[model samples]
Target: MTDQELQTLVEKVSQESFRQPFCHNARFNQRLKTTGGRYHLQSHDLDFNRLVFEKYGTAELIKVIKHELCHYHLHLAGRGYQHKDLEFKQLLKKTGGSRFAPLLAPVVFQVYQCQQCQKMVKRRRKIDTKKYVCGGCQGKLKFLKTIEA
Candidate 1:
């Protein structure tokens, strides 16, 4: 969904779930990694990872919205908005927000195998087999299939 749609959704969820209106901005931040959403303390703006909706669908996105809304509403009211606080925990549980985001797929890594010792190696970037040899036996290394960790 677009940023406009996300803003509307955050506003709607804030009203419906928290009984408070979200006055600040809400937008998708492509730079966000791992976390499903973030609530800026100073700006009161909410940022959601677009990949959440793309991978997990709208239901999960709504949960993430609720999670961020918990932070937004609590922080605005000057209550204990931190995750460690009782108020935050109670509100989050009451709102049915996710305590933790679901893990995304592991990163894929390039695999290499030693021709002599048959030792396996994984690297984030492609390495030249001609230059790099197996550490075990100084044997020739062959590029293997890439696999996810």
Candidate 2:
């Protein structure tokens, strides 16, 4: 969603869930790598990871928004807002917010192909080309490429 759409969504969510109007901006931030979302105390704005929504879709995005809204509303009301606070935990549970961001799977697979038989093989860990041979024909196995999950 665009920044304007995100802003509207934040306002809507605040009104429906918290019974408060969010008079601040909400925007997609491409530079956000790990976190799902962030709430700026000084600006009172919400910044969301664009990749989270793009990769995981709306349901995941909503959960992330709820997580950030917890920070937004609590900080604005002068309540306990940090992740470790009891109030924050209670509010997060009540609002069904995600406790931690979901991580992508690891990239450890290496793909190989037998040069003579052209058979494909996928290995979790890399193999020594000089020591390993194709299972089917005992032919030479050539490294094709590595894939990351």
Candidate 3:
């Protein structure tokens, strides 16, 4: 969904779930990696990871919005909004918000093969064949990159 649509959804969930109006902006942030969403105390704005919707769908998105709204509302009301706070925990439970961000897809790893021994090696980082040798026979490794995932 577009950022405008996301903003509307956040505002709607805020009102429905928290009984509070989210006056600040809420937008999809492509740069957000692991977190489902974030509430900025300085601006009172909410930034959600677009991947959350893409990977988990609307239901998951709503949960994330609710989670962020808890932070937004509690902080605005001058109550404890941190994760460890009792008020935050109670509000999150009342709203059925996710306690933690959803897990992201595992990163694909590159695989290399030794042509001589036909041994395979897996690595998250790229390896220089010139500097690295195969473990099996100390044979030279060649790039046979394939995603482990």
Candidates ranked by lDDT: 3, 1, 2
1 or 3, greater by TM-score? 1
Q: Sorted on TM-score, highest at the top, how do the candidates line up?
A: 1, 3, 2
What residue pairs clash in candidate 2, if any at all?
none
Winning model by TM-score = 1
Per-candidate TM-scores read: 0.74, 0.70, 0.73
lDDT values for all models? 0.91, 0.88, 0.91
Instruction: Please report, as a residue range, the 10-residue window in candidate 2 with the lowest summed lDDT.
Output: 100-109
Write model 2 residue lDDT over 1-149, tens digit each, in one string. 88888888878887887788888889998888878888898999989988877889888888888889999999999999999999999999998889997663455789999998999999999999899999889999999998886
Off by over 4 Å in 3: 107-149
- Candidate 3 accuracy as lDDT: 0.91
Writing each residue's lDDT as its tens digit, candidate 3 over 12-126 gives: 9988998778899999887899899989989999999999999999999999999999999999999999999999999999999999989875777989999899988899899
lDDT of 1 by residue, 28-137 (tens): 99888888999999888999998899999999999999999998888888999998999999999999999988775578899999999999999999999999999889
> Which portions of model 2 miss their true places by more than 4 Å?
104-149
Clashes of each: 0, 0, 0
Residue 50 of model 3: what lDDT?
90
Q: Candidate 1, 136: how far from true, in Å?
A: 14
